[model samples]
Target: MKRKFLLLTTFCMMVLAACAPGGGSDSEESNAVSGDGGSGKQVLDFWYIDPGEKEKVYQEAVERFEEKHPDVEVKMLRVANDAYKQKLAVSMSGGNAPDIFNSWGGGWLKQFVDQGQVLDVTESIEKERFNELALDNTTFHDKIYGLPLGLSLDLVFYNKEIFEEYGLTPPETYTEWVEIIETLKENNIIPIALANQTKWPGAYYLMNFAARIGGPDLFNEAFLREGRGFDDPAYVEAGEYIQEMVEMDAFNPGFNGVPYDEGQGRQLLYSGQAAMMDITMSLVNNVRTEAPEFEEKMDFFVFPTVEGGQGSNKAVGASTGPVWSVAADTENPDLATELIQELTSQETAEAYTNRTGSLTAVSGVEPEDEFVNRMYQVAEEATHLQMPYDQTLPPELAELHKDTTQALFGLSITPEEAAEQMEAKAKEVLE
Candidate 1:
């Protein structure tokens, strides 16, 4: 949800180039691939942030790509999660960037796009080939800059067993949701499990609350420099609602101490330490593999709608965060474009869904994983698929939003005060 660069220093680039782990062509030391047709072949450098077996899937795809285009060779680089962004920043703005790289097309990508680091491949791609929701972040100013690889949705994943024990069903409205939370508390059960150690998880609540209160347009309008801004009544009301939930002790005890990614939050849900969790759809695989019994007990529901709010009940919180973008400085734009096209094609989407048990952005590929398939259905029914506010806003303001949202959850700042802080920050950065 957070990313950017102050400046891509030459020293930083050098460091990244030296330290980055190389894949594909074992002979290539750096990404400055030669495009000379003297050998009747072109070489392209690609960087990706695939943490596990995804790299293996991509490797197979690269092999298939090589077989298809015998004259083009791809120099793939696999970077670890922690270092990928900074390395990518340096490689893009300071030095010769890879011909293509993995990106999340949002305000983070906007910075690179503004610096002319990424290419506009509008004509190269078919806009209708992708889900419009996934494509939301891929375009800027009516031009496409990237291709969506996968889709992720955030919903409340609850332990159905726990719910049944408490005679609970998924709530359809905000008031019902609050009553359920209160019921869970009275029964000495934690209603929602929260983990704010990384901050984005907490920000999800704020984003969804705002979306339900103001509908999809309000946040977009505010971020696009409209009159509403961060001081909009809806955002403040979201914060106020969050504060009220916190005051009611709806979240797990010591939730602020739990980290989201390091197995803490997921552990809480699967172990029955908590009844429900707001989680990204990608966790289905992990839940499937690690806790099959728990998986059977798990089911998700979209965040409930506000009773008299502007947003529709169908507006679910989802994002197409990871995208593959071609670098602007690539010598072989045709080859780079073709490669990304193939990677995001219908066949590849099906292959990726099969291999990873996740959903891809390509419209036709129905994921084999049942949970992911259901999530795909959820995305299809959405009136508006909203990206996390922290990802949609400009870099600095996004960070501010995350921090203030976390603070709101922690009860350190009142909702009005949080809105005031965000308005001041947004004015400084945008105005």
Candidate 2:
């Protein structure tokens, strides 16, 4: 009886010993914990779309954030701009969305907001610290969902040397601008460098044209379903302007075949083959890096006003840069929010502006470069800023807008047809 009792007692002690804290492997220990995952540190997954120097800035911010919070770890992931939206959607659908993700505000982020996938940071972020226009893109239903980090405005970037060689200066009116294109074409220079293969670049022309012709009221009415909608004459006239430019042979040969994100259009400007490109402000960094010497020859002007148009030249086609948003289901909400504050800190914003010559959302932050400052001034003084259709409209309608705009550029679809298609899609999706 005594031996049997000893044997059972020994077995029970052995079982208890095996289940103790030190008995398991390190990974097993991590899995046993609440949130440390075995590294004894809280881990937050952060995803962003900027891949080059901008990525480095984000890395530095992450490092700073980690240093400030020794108990936290941030795993920074860079997803390509082209693949980011789709990848984020897949992750969200699988219940594996990153704790923090970078996004373009407007309809792109609005979908996530509507799905309850985004956290409302209204109370966390101070509205007064950001530029109102920048914040406007991230705000939905009067609640702020993300932190605006920078502003992106489109302008006509021109080669000063090429302009001087042809005795041309920036135009003050749309008619004058068309005349400039004619002069450039007469000189055998591609008046504009556009990569419409990806479609968005060409859409800029139509967007800017419409904005200049009909003003904010036209687009506001169409978007809100309160007035004429996209089929309004203003949009059709915008298409006519693009077709006119096409007839003048203003764009590069096979412009519709080149891709903007690949730097093909910028190459045209660098080689002096094309005189100008209407693109986002990031062109400053692109020029500084791809062809440093060409930076000296670079200058910019806002889209000029159209004769007899309702929109002022002060109106600009712009959008917020990648805004940082916290996942609604993040495990470490406080940590994620703190990290965002660090990422958008004044030091970080200044560093980004100084390094890239682009405008950040941080109030009072401006580029130090004199030429870049001029572009910044334009954005600052803008009377009305129109967010790109792709970003402003829902995903389905946005794709249709880009497609129709591309078709317009290819001369495959009439402006009226494109406008009708847009209104139809908008009604189906929005109404």
Candidate 3:
């Protein structure tokens, strides 16, 4: 009886020993604790930029993802917009990047790819059915490294009442646009609400102008370090357009001093101090929330065609919004990839659009707002969607592009000098 008891006690001790840390069963060491036993589940640190209501929208998606993937855990971290870029750069360089994180694609995300820090998602899942234009931003070379979440279009938002007062319709050609600007100036009205202090506001005009003058090829040539670069005549012509608008006194008085985020810029549009404003799709809700009455008064138009240019006015001045890229160093590639797809899936895309009013990249999902739907129409019809240089270029180059554009608007630099300055900055980046 003593011998039998000793044998049983020895067996129990061996079992307990095998389950503890290094001595535990190899399976136990590999698995995460869930209940009484262990779960061979992985946790993915998911990071995202919070676009206002996306916090709540994404929380719901997380809940759903957790329910469907009980074995995989998704840990979400949200960062503010301005801080997100710096935060992402630091984390990636530090080798502690989240398993899956947000990116603006183009040059910003390209840095990660060059470092071999992002997973090549070419064959992980099906992406063929998505809008190819939307996919263009996240795709590097022929392989896709990330999934685009939505479309962010740039449009000219005008108060319908104000346009009627001026006896103007949304201009369909560049000539008509200039005429309208002149008419507004003659009427002693601010032609457009602009806040050049921020620089990005000026980028909208430059982006559209460059696209109109040179088409996607010019920007692409500059971006890819191909023939001609930003020194192309197209850029010079685009700079001239910027100067022309400045000469027409198009933007609000003292616009160079008004700040973008302090409500001063948007207030100009809301209070009818300005007739039109170049804005992003997301600003629809801002108008609805802050100036509800003017929300009904708001209408939008795409950038008009230039009379003598190789450009397609049909192409929208837009972005693929933000994309989610999986880290190449993640131990949880399968879960990370799945989480990214799930976040950008058709259902989630529709949900995001409905909740936030942003036009998603998902083809079939539609926003109920007619104004938003019109924005989507422009996106769908775009022969090419051009990324703004400020967002598409490297940080230093982007800042310089913005600065030169602001200089053009402030009349501190001639169009020729503006183009030259931008081209000089471009060579430093493109090479």
Candidate 4:
């Protein structure tokens, strides 16, 4: 099995190298919002990356928040996902950062925390109120910097109707998983609906596979230079697993060219052209919103265990959804803290979950929707919820990881080569 992958690696790399490193994000204008919007009320500018239905939910929450405060006004600014980091950086540098902003809680937020740009809200938030897994990224050096808004886990979401038609049950091991993929292919069905054109979508495979092969501590040890680092055999082996799948036609045709944000792969699932999707739990909201009828047919299973692997089957690839943190320089720390509390309060948590069909990090909030309940359970059961590499690693190394992983999926780089590239960069940056 591995020999086949070794034989295909060089050839695939040569054939696809020229087409790697897909396009960039479209430049967007971001105006620095001031805390004083000219209103007499105590104004608080809040920036977040949610733009559509999520914005609506936040707006409703803000309305209630206003109703409670009466004298304070919250200004909500929705920023584009790709443009947000730069926007926040610019605003923070200009000393006009929002009172509170949503941030991914790993290396992304750590930089701000290190620079004293983020407030340590440890006293403001009750540590016992959130799931420990959700707090992993936000807590640095024994202090919490942000409040997690939601929890997102990556798992294999399958179409129950399609599974029933084929008499297939979710697999519990890697070998069984491959059998399912092969079986799907035999029937001319796409085994997995993956949109790798954006790069990050495909990195999940490598992350989850590495977690299963090397267990939870592999990446962290490698990242901190305690172990073999990125050249760890687990990473290479994970890459090999991905390539084997690519050679076996596990993903859709032209998967390297499909963009996830455009809903291409999801469309396949919606049409039943694909059997399963190993994607984020956020897909729950999209399905419930755009294809409500399909919700009943959808269910998920955790990524299967690998034969003789050191990792637990319960380990998960997960990230806390945008966590809200107060700016360290805010003049009204008390008011800002109160607003953060209001936003992630029990009422808002329930409202957010109800409106989005997603799991909030708030403890004791069970999603009424059955499918989302499964996602919630998976998050609960996760022994090691690994944050995505791009978020957990520094910006430059993170980009390299995505690019090389994308190249790996495109088979434009051999597993060994990809691992080597990552190790070299990690050494340069971290050492």
Candidate 5:
């Protein structure tokens, strides 16, 4: 009996000893698996332009992405629009570039691609689902480099109350536009709110007018072709048109000294002091937030057409928004590609557009804001969408165009002289 009892005790002791170590091994294995989980906490550095009130939306998206990607951490860096390019260039040259960043289309992307600074995200992204022009803009030298997040069509925004008080509908042609200006002037309302001191905003008017008068293909061919210049009569005519408007008191007083953002031009429109302002679709959300009561009073239309011109009926401009690209030397190029693909997906594109009240690169996403919706419809119906002249032209030539346009506004130079100066500057650059 004693021997049998001792045998049972021995068997029990052996079973407990075996089970204890096995349980410990199981816990250790679980810790190992979790600590070294798939792809393991990769830190991605991302840079973008001013997110404004939309920063919250981006933050929420980042949180959701992290939840799904448990192994990845995203750090966002926001830069001011005016200084972004310089900062990016410095960062890239110093070997401290972010894993992902944003750029402008066409020449901007072309420069980066030529320098081998950005990764090719062509096959990585679903290009078949994006807007054709948006996709086209990011392609350079037969290679795809970036994904366009939004569309940026130029539209004329007018204050309904100001227009109603002066009894003006949106003009359909250049002649009608001139008449509207005259009518508004007689009624004591500034016809246009032009703030030329910042130069680019003023250049938008000049460049689009040139496109409307010269045809869409003309400037592209001239600017892109070797040994060509902006001496065309169309350029002169556009300059003259702006000069005429300036002489007619079309702009508010002290326009040349006003900054683009803080200028009286935007405030004038919101306060119903100005009849019209030419700006991007993105500005709609800003106007709504700044003047909620004036929300219903705002409307948009395309710039008036010029008679006997190739691009008379076309929309001549787009905004300078961010295009997403990956670092060419990323340690995880595949993962970087995946991130861009996700960022430019239909869902993300729509979220960006909806948040900014801007047009998305994705087709079939309707804008919720009435003005933005109308602008999108106008852009879609238009025959062509010309890249903004400043973007298309060489940087030196673009600066010349701005200076000449500002000179015309200041009466420091005649329209003929402005045209002559532009040709000279273009010649210097081309030579």
Candidate 6:
């Protein structure tokens, strides 16, 4: 499967490159100019990754801003997800960054903040309007550097049709979840759709599981302590659980090699080959687009309660989606702030949520997509929204988390070994 995905990706890249007029030598810098004719309106540049069909929602907000402010012109750049971070980094280093750009909550933005490249939005915006978890994510060193536009919770998305076919409902506890997997196996169906080859997706699942077993507070304590090891009993327990599932053949064949695109893990659920998948709320949109016929059969639920675990039954993993931040050196700071306000306002939030089936960071804006709305409802009910470990921990430690988790699946090491490694890496980073 890895070979197949690689070939497909390579082929697509070649075709796209051939079709384009130029190679990938475009400068990352934005040519934005602020200040309207002499004393006119200000112009701002905003950069973000394409959010499926929600581009127009953002454009409309910019239009509204222009109408109200008349003197301001907003330029929007839709960058690819893989290119956004690197491009923004380059632009920042060159001192030609966009007025506003998207950024992750953790290390990605941390590096910029450390370099004094991002503006602190906490002072300009009212953080109360956003979810507490979302706000917490952007807050670093007692200052918030960005405004969250959306959020994503890591949860289990199951195929209603598949579940019903196998006489299963969303499991309410980890024990039940294990039973459901066994039942699915009995019926010759894969219990989970996992695309471990993409690496990040698998990491999310591991983080979610570990958080549940260790409990958010304890997990965070371990993550923040230097010389703390990943080989903690709780961490090992989570890894062993995942490894057990892998050994049971709960995932689709070759799942470890499937990339995110090409419908990899999702394909299993859509095709009725798998019963469940652990993924972000965005999967609802993907399912709607790629398998509309199965749309009605799709549903989601929080990860089941871990038996005898320290985590609360309602504990769930989540993170603020990429946020919009302004370059500290922007020629027009006020214009950039205004653009952010417009972009994350109630109207734009609603439109983006409705168009992309995403949960908005803005309060009081309900998601229009039923599945997404349901996810938000469940997430809100959770006692705690534990940020995914990868996003909450330092980058170096996060990578170790992923590597050890993957190693567990490959049976190269026991869960104890993996946890020990995680602890060692966490300690090094935290100290």
Best by lDDT: 2
Off by over 4 Å in 5: 1-41, 226-229, 417-431
Tens-place lDDT digits, model 5, residues 319-428 = 43567788886666776677776666667767777777778777778878676677677777776777765655555677677788888778788777887887777767
Q: How do the residues 8-69 of candidate 4 rate in per-residue lDDT, one tens digit apiece?
A: 99779966764354211111112222344346578888998864566777788788878988
lDDT of 5: 0.74
Using alpha carbons, what is the TM-score of model 3?
0.83
**lDDT computed for candidate 3:** 0.79
Give all TM-scores, in the order shown. Answer: 0.84, 0.90, 0.83, 0.87, 0.83, 0.85
Worst 10 residues of 1 by lDDT: 24-33
User: Please, what are the lDDT tens digits per residue for candidate 1 over residues 1-431?
Assistant: 12335344656887787766544233332444345544757888889876454566677778889999998888889886446777998766655688989977888888888888889999988899998868878899899999998888888999899889989999988899998999888888788988787788888888888988988788878877875778889999999889888999989877777876577778888888788888777667667566767878989899888867888768877777459999887888998998998788777778777766677888888877787678778877777888877666778898899889888988988899999999899878887
**Best-to-worst lDDT order:** 2, 4, 1, 3, 6, 5
State the lDDT at 316 in candidate 2: 90
lDDT of each: 0.81, 0.87, 0.79, 0.85, 0.74, 0.77
Best candidate, TM-score-wise? 2
**Superposing every Cα of model 2 onto the true structure, what RMSD results?**
7.8
Clashes (backbone N, CA, C under 3 Å), per candidate, total: 0, 1, 1, 0, 0, 12
Q: Compared with the true structure, what per-residue lDDT tens digits does model 3 show for residues 45-97? A: 88887546666767777778889988777778888765777898887776667
Which ranges in model 3 have alpha carbons more than 4 Å from their true place?
Answer: 1-43, 70-75, 186-188, 257-259
Which stretches of candidate 1 lie above 4 Å from their native place? Answer: 1-43, 50-56, 69-83, 186-188
